[model samples]
Target chain A: MSDKPKILILDDEEDLLATYKDLLTNLPSKPEIYTTTNGARAVAMLDAEQFSLLITDLHMPEIDGFQVLAIVRRRFPELKILAISSVLEEQYRARAYSLGVDMCWQKPGTENEIKMFFDCIESLLEERPSEGFRGIQNKSLVDLIQLECICRNSTTLKVISGGIEGKIYILDGEIIDAEFGNLTGDIAFKKLISLKKGSFEYLPAVTERERKIFSSTDGLLLDAAQTIDETTAEDKSEVPDASETGDRTALVKPVIAMSKIDGVDFILIGELKSPQPSDSWGVDDSKNLHKWISNTVQLWRSFGDKFLCGELKDIFLYGHHCKVVLKTKENKLLCAGFKATVNNETIPNLMKDVIALWV
Target chain B: MGLTKAKKDQSIKLIITKPGSFTVDANGNILSSTLPLSVPDKFIEIIIHNVLETFLTARASGLIFEEVIIQFIGLKIVAREMRGGALIHLTPLKP
Candidate 1:
């Protein structure tokens, strides 16, 4: 955040932009002022330079104010946004707030309305909230692109996270091109926007950045979300699909989440009645594994009772093939099979961490 | 894990690990018993078979059971491989 307030005015009309610039100079704060008639230029300026306040016109050419607001709102958390529109519709105002706009107003027409507009700006520039901000700050990159395309932004964006960098071009509210590493078109867009975390910077659109992606922004987002969800579900290793395990989902969730981490090869919930595992992670369709777990429990329970071990809690089986931790709860046996590569000393703590949440 | 000679010497107090015990053969047949079990030999044999048979079956499937520790609310059973049989011990769990 800048020490002194910096305000940027974005309007399609150069005359209105000039008037706002001249009027804001009267404020006692003497904040730096920037004006741009091009919405793309305004977004690039906001990204390149840190500005404390952004005053944008909702109805603009090339790119509208709502797109600019969505783009900058998350990228710059501390910055305040004020939206002005010629056709002050109720839905547009609502849309602006949803996009993280702090305040929205009709463009000044009457002298009294003009005076009030200037007064609101002066107060907004001067006042700082002691409490935290209200609007949602964690919008996904896919959402940002959707908003950009919705407003028909003819701009380019460079998305980056960790070692991966991708470029997406939205021409008139449609994804025309995308490039990530060697991948291109819709595949590149899906892979790029599907990234879990990243920062996006505005870029000037190239005239010849070929139309690689034919799908609309909405289609692309849906495709990307679906693609990513399937990959995540597979990575989680739920044999029966955790989403479909309606009744046992609550207990199955934590186990599903912990799969493949800490060398846990497979996790299983063995219902004494079911021949197969009720819910499993990283486990194949094997009935013998489930039977082995049930038999192991029965044997351990009998030993614990006969030898005065009392109410059976859990059993740890260490072997040459693999290590197994079995926890008996009611009629269900919560089981985890470990990879041989995992150190034996750390298996107990790791098992507890994996099953601790619900079991 | 085993204690070193230094640790053994530092641990001067006597520790009674076995409160009661029994032994089972590789086929899960009761070999001997020291702690008079309330359950009959048939129930004991049934349990031993249920557990060790499964253990052997798992071993055949490339998952051999070297040692198994069964924890309970008030006691613990640590079974270690002895020859082809199992050496089972019972001890009260310290709160």
Candidate 2:
């Protein structure tokens, strides 16, 4: 019988995986270690085997580490779990604690801290509690409100109750961006901060480029409208002519046209290159590539109204290059023809995939 | 003789201070001055129209003039040149 305790470590960073493997190998017992880059895969592995300890990074592709914690707590109440995150956002920390995580560790500057975390786990394993902790019950909207009142999380709580959406942005869990449907900006955000919510959903963080594009469109529209009003006032004395108004209208039309499309979004372009003598394009690689493309297309398809007009130029796979073209609805070209050699294909595809997701 | 010589000297000084502006005609030859140069209002209007047209076209094609200034001399006008042959200076209106 193997006397050493088993451990599972899940993180997206490949280098971190190697580092953890090295660390674990040097330990006295040389416990069995399992490493995976994704949370979903880790969950599947957990279901198949028994591990004394589970260490997971918070942010990951597909499912986040927090969600993994939730799933584990529901199915396997006895397992010890540690939450690791690069972001030290209070909301994330609070949520981790609320989910009954045993310990939370921050990454990058805390190598010694991780060693300490393992020591604590070792002690906890020695003394096992007889009765397992019960999982949290599914709450109704009223129950959620009562929970918020008892333990206020200082942030916005956006709730969708009975098919109607409302926001309550809480400061120390006080309500703040509350409105019925699709409200944004300072006023809406302020309103949300003041609500006593039903149940709420946190809005996803937007990229810097997305914010800039939206603000710029708003400014351009305001300027155009101001220009029209001024022109009308100046021409009040003169007899109104249709041709003059038409020219004035033309000046503002371009601003209006550009505003209709969100320029920050990018389209993914895929390219395939002929394999070299040393290159290997086996079945596994081809399958992975196809899966990546299909998943990306499906995501964009879900947001049909936001990005329906965008086009995906045919995949360009040939000699040493492939490229994607992203253009606006106005047919104004944003980025054109990005190519990567066969030897360095991953970067170009990743770039295309990210841009497509952003769009 | 003295009065006539003095008057000729003044006219020469005026011409020197306010160099005549030029533009390309239909045949592409540089026309020395705008037609009816003595009429200040008409001359100024025509010059402004031409300048605005050139400015708009250059701006659309992403070109910019480094300096654009109008200078005026007594009763005669001259415009300095910049990139893309943009005339910069203007002369005072001739009464």
Candidate 3:
């Protein structure tokens, strides 16, 4: 009913909320301004009241800014949407446009951009149309997170918060790397990844060239990080016994390698012994032993599919009455017998020696 | 007592005579035996452990062990002819 247009601003930052409120309050028409620190609360307000313009920041706890846009487009089609962020990247901008964002404003060096955004909003409010594609918002930190998640992308996400820059690498939705200005990798990830409840500011406008470089380098890092995260998560979730955990972790590499083996891969361990004349009770005994060996080989071959390569031609197993051997397509040779065993005490120790060869 | 003991002594004695060595390739192929006469027990254990460990670690590290093998040696030794040995094969798990 008031002559002034009503505007709602949503962001998780209290300071930004106040700043925007102060900015809007000083305007000529004295627009009615409403602010909240979360997208969910903002939606609640929207459900209760009608507003001429809606401004939102992308990153926030619980519901994110994009989800807010999606909701507005679906439920409140008539509302003019303006997206604001400090970290504006290309992919995010593209997404914002697809979601029907009217104006995208980058926070830094963009005071005038905000003013122009309002001007466009005023013009659009005067003549509402059926449907039109609005300008895309700049890429926000939230946008980057979403993009990474959707692509199952792995990389270090650097965010400038307060006066410090924080970096976190997400691999397969698991946080594997994090650094708050100084620390990085495992230590950082351990410290910060769990602090999901805190609020932080981020700069959104990274250069295009820098973004491209980041995507390439961070991509590989992210993939590795994801693998670690997944393993760690599995370890934690399953709460496997220490020995089992050790066994499982050890298998990770071999499984991946076995999957990658071109045709067939074989591994053998233990000493082989022939049946003594006194031990050979009858011919049926040898046949039984062969059957057992065959069964074990079949079981081992079944696991080959779980490896990274997933295709194996054949595996030839040979061993004394108590020995075992496996052969693959790449090369044929005996590995890790008496000399290696005497050198190491435990199975893990011997395995470590074996793995060292590949590394 | 003498008659019972003598009768019990008539049972046949079982002796293992197989001779082999434990061997493992880098491809995670594990072969272990206790029948071969030439392979050593320590080498066989190492081979078995290495093969299983290779599989486990590979799963953990996201890498692969191409092949592994282990052979066992079984032979009777009166005084000293029991020098045991094992052969190891290792390669990358390449696609």
Candidate 4:
């Protein structure tokens, strides 16, 4: 076997692919390099041969960079993935990170960009994991497992956190099953993934096991992300906000005056009605706040609740930029917009005072 | 006249619902769903619980409503109230 490390380059652009291959070939390491224009073909090559590193572009046609990253993440957890993209959008970069890519480089096609790219590649190659039970710090366990799947390493991941212990069974880079107490499959997997302060030890795969969950690796990641998001949404409702400090002493604040909660922004008071008619509430013209709320109520009513009362009690929505806490009085709908940091406990009381004063 | 419908893809991708506890007894807590497996039950429970709480809070406050659309970074959720429970749809806008 050749002593040189093997490298794979995947890009749709033939010229760039060849150029990258040439650059890596001349490095002092003198690595054995391969190039492919098709993402699918590159994946096939990955399965057929052992590659020390993978450098792929993000915008390929048939099988894009993200797809390739997801597949490699599942089947080849040991293989380090480097993503190159001409479109350096934050959303794309974040997605790549979540999928377990080691590094993302924006391909500017300049000499300096090429030089920095090569330097990055050299650094990553020098720092590749070679020993058993290597210490990886400051990464989410979920991300780490995704990395293991990408490396295609069959290993037992043991996680210890706060007097709790769990074991995850990954066979041939697929998370065959996991165990934490009586939980198994996805339940156990999610518990392990949600450990924020845990230490993990990875031992080489031992006993073979039957697959208990058939979802793809990306599916697993997606489920984990959703689970975390929902947990955060729930937690936000219980957690006290820093802003809850100074605002509690006052009791006689006017309805219009009560609109400004420390972390909350715009406040709209309108009658609960359909969108067009809700325009009469006219809280703001810059944005149809009343119309949106009315439409929202309309959507809520369509869920087959034939006996829905004429009033909706409260609706708290957390979206991009703003979070809203909405309440309904006898004839008025109160929509209070707040930042994510608004204290959950203060919402009901705050809305109550505003409704008592106004309605 | 009888109503007709167009043929569409039958694959059930995602399911969203209000939690089972608040629903009338025996309707079985699932206010809505389209997924095949009952797996990820906890995740489903958490989501539905929050949705149900929001609607119940609205009902208690006497706000008569139809639907709610919530937008997150990569997700758009629509929850509509129905006869016995609510229907929720989760759509991922990005990866």
Best by lDDT: 1
Worst 10 residues of 2 chain A by lDDT: A274-283
Error of 2 at B11 (Å): 99
The candidate with the higher DockQ, 1 or 4, is 1
Q: What residue runs in model 2 are displaced by over 4 Å at the alpha carbon?
A: A108-111, A124-131, A134-359, B1-95
Query: Per-residue CA lDDT of candidate 4, range A113-187, in tens?
Result: 778888888888777554222246446777788888998888998876544667888877888888887788889
Query: Ignoring the other chain, what TM-score does chain B have in each prediction?
Result: 0.58, 0.33, 0.33, 0.59
Docking class of 4: incorrect
Question: In model 3, what is the error at residue A298, expressed in angstroms?
Answer: 69
Report the C-alpha displacement of residue B39, candidate 1, in angstroms. Answer: 9.2
For residues A1-359, write the lDDT of model 3, one tens digit per residue.
24577788999888978987987776666777777776765765665456778988876778888999987766665577888778989888888877767777666456677787656656655554332212212333343555676776655565432224476666654344456757765555433433222223333322221221134334644554565577568768776564655654453433233312222122232212312211111122332333333343444333332222233333322222111223222222222222221212243343344444333
Q: What's the DockQ for every one of the candidates?
A: 0.27, 0.01, 0.02, 0.02
> Best to worst by DockQ, what's the order?
1, 3, 4, 2
lDDT of each: 0.72, 0.45, 0.47, 0.63
Each candidate: how many clashes?
Answer: 2, 29, 131, 46
| Poorest stretch of ten by lDDT in candidate 4 chain B | B1-10
TM-score of chain B of 3: 0.33
Give the candidate number with the greatest TM-score.
Answer: 1
Q: Candidate 3: misplaced stretches above 4 Å? A: A108-111, A114-359, B1-95
Residue A344 error for model 3, in Å?
Answer: 73
